[model samples]
Target chain A: MRYAYYPGCSAHSTARDMHESADAVARLLGIDLVEMKGWSCCGATSAHQTDRVMAASLPAANLLLAKEMGLDTVVTCAACYSRMKTANHEITSSADMRAAVADAVGQPYDGSVKVRHFVEILLEDFGIDKLRKRFKKSLNGLKVASYYGCLLVRPGNVTHFDDPENPTSLDRLVTAMGGESIDWPHKVECCGGGLNLTRTDVAVKLSSSIVEMAAASGADCIAVACPMCQASLDLRQKDIDAATGKKHHMPVLYITQLLGLCLGIPEKELGLSRLMVSPAGVLKALQPASSHQV
Target chain B: MTIKIKKQSGKSLRQTVEEMSGVDMSLCYQCKKCASGCPVTKYTQSPPSEIIRRLHLGAGDELLESDLVWMCLSCETCYGRCPMDINIPAVIDALRSLALEKGSKSPRGDMPLFNRKFLEAVKAYGRSYDLSMIMGYKLGSGSLMQDVEKFPSMLAKGKMAVLPPSGAEKKVVKRIFDRSKQAKGKKK
Candidate 1:
């Protein structure tokens, strides 16, 4: 299958490591992600919180591009995916929004384009059975706390992603990779992705709990699909420890990075070195003395 | 506990917010389900349900001055849990827009400063350039010394793109901003 891929602004900035791993995994999995010639930013929370017209129009510009390409839009960033889905919901539902987006982009938006997340595409479009068959190395019961930041599954009518409260899409993907997907209470916790830079104090208060909850679930590492969550948790991890008086050194890994490991993709190719928190210790403990596939 | 009462001008806060957000304010039954899921309640003065309550009571001035509008995460957790299907985040956005328009002094100036710089970058270039926006935010907010330690490591690890993003249609994006502003002006 093919899609019009949107590499959000974070892919070039804070989430380059995630972009590299996810791109490598997508290629290896035989899904063709065709990027458009000229794609603009989706204007994340800054647009949505401050201005309504901008919130819809920014995503509408990209949706217009995808519609022109005659392919559905696929985005890796959960925030971008949310914006695209929201723009579609607005333009399709209201006539005022439709007129505003049309006047903004200078193009009529009929809202025919479908926005999908990479993880969901892998599970739904690319069959889980096929993905499981390609797993070469055993996870050796490498337990993971599947972390879904808000956008991945929330405001159910907009995203239509999964169960808003108890999303299992990530957990299902982890299980397919021969890894143990642990059920943790904070799996769907909000990490305050929007307030990362401006009001980090608020973000810190929210992100620290996810790390603590992961440890409580007996998981070695946390897997996430959103860059905002990865950046908030991984980048602020040391600070979280310093502030909370906790000695936990949990490595936050992208779902794609974990899948890359199971697919036998080289560590360098997956950009594992770029991760702020090292996963060397966690990967070292992946093997048992018996080397059994249990 | 001290309760503050304030009188609002012509239109009730509920009518204005409902018009801007398209979410019917009367449906909220004060179930407080949204409060249970809100993450930043500890940091803000009001919970999600209480913000709605303030709107119902026509406490516009109180809502504008509170830090709750600035502290929302936009995580949609409250919206997901609300039985009335009220999108508290949307209502908060509307309140924030109203506050910005009214020029109410925000307790947290850095948040609006950051958003303004972020959109300014998008308005200029087709996509957001993180470096320049951060610099503008630092200069504007007078917090230049903050996060200075992370730059060197970020560059060495290829975590940041030093140059501005190209390949997007800048003129088209600029028009989007101009048109949006014009549309808002027309509404007002």
Candidate 2:
């Protein structure tokens, strides 16, 4: 199946592994990812706070671009998926409000394109059984905590692809790839997004709790859908350890990375080296004799 | 110290905070998940969840006097974890603004001055320059002895860059900042 893809800003920068792993998986699944050209930021936590119109407009513009391309958009990043889905919902459900927003943007938004999260597309379209059939190698005995951060689930109808309170899309995906998924509290908790800029201390504390909880729940690694989530859990873990005087060195992996590994993709191609905590040991435990060179 | 209740406006503190910030303060079930997950709550008397509860109790005057409001790093963990999706960070920010407007002094005297220093740094550079921010904070707080040993290591490791990364359109960022400040001023 062919779908228009929106990688979002983080996919281009810190979380480039997400894009790489996604591309590898799409190729393996025979899915065509046509990237939306000249796309802008999703306006994440900032735009929604400062200006509602701008927030809606940014995602709306991306939707319009996808519509122009004549395909339903599949977003890899959870935050992008949430923003795009929210914009689509608003434009379709509320006519008067949609008209005002369209007027502000000087474009007619007919809400033609459908926004699907990568996980949704995998579950609904690709199916977990198909993923299992495609897996050349299994992630046996790998304990993973499937963390679905706030943006992907909350605000209800906007992102109606899954049960926000108890999302199991990632868990199903992990199981399909032969990994054990752990049930843990703080799975849907916020990683304190852009608040890292204004409140590093707060970000560290919140992120640390998530890691601690995941560890307590017997998770060897935390699997995340958002780049910001990965960043908070991976990059700031050292600071959390320093502040609390406890060592938390859990390797955080993008769900797509795990999928790629299960599909027998080489570790270097998956950009496993880019991660702060090496996923080599984790990968080796998942797949014996899988020495991660480089 | 006896806790004295003051009678004032028709609306309670909870009502006012909810109306202003669009956060349902009563939705906070006091799970203290917010406090438990909070980074800076350990340094404050009242945690974020407690502050929200106080506001819900119509303790507007008393809420304003809280150090909790100023202590919030606005990391948005509370908002992210909240089942109700209440923007707790924004509510805290609103409370801080209200306290400043009402001439309520921070129980921790360094907080207000630290905020001003951050704003001043942002205004001047159109972005946060960490060294300048740290210097400003130290000068404002009168605590230079803190973390002095780590500074050399940080500089050596290139973690503390002397200058911010280039490519920031200073004029455009400045305009955005100015516009937001003006809008905030008008609201005040």
Docking quality tier of candidate 2? incorrect
Query: Which lDDT value does model 1 have at A290?
Result: 34
**Over 4 Å off in model 2, which ranges?**
A90-96, A110-112, A288-294, B1-188
Query: Candidate 1 at A163: error in angstroms?
Result: 0.9
A213-281, model 2: which lDDT tens digit per residue? 998899989898888888788867777788778997799999999988878888877767778777866
Interface RMSD of each: 1.2, 7.0
- Per-residue lDDT for B1-188 in model 1, tens only? 44465887798878888998999988999999888878887787788888887777777666777777888888898888887788788898898888887888855746888888889888877888889988998898877877687788778778878998888878788998888778678767
Q: In order, what lDDT does every prediction score?
A: 0.84, 0.70
Model 1 Cα lDDT, one tens digit per residue, A15-74: 898889889999998888898668999988889878887899899888888888899998
Every candidate's chain B TM-score: 0.94, 0.79
Proportion of native contacts present in model 2: 0.03
Highest TM-score: give the candidate number: 1
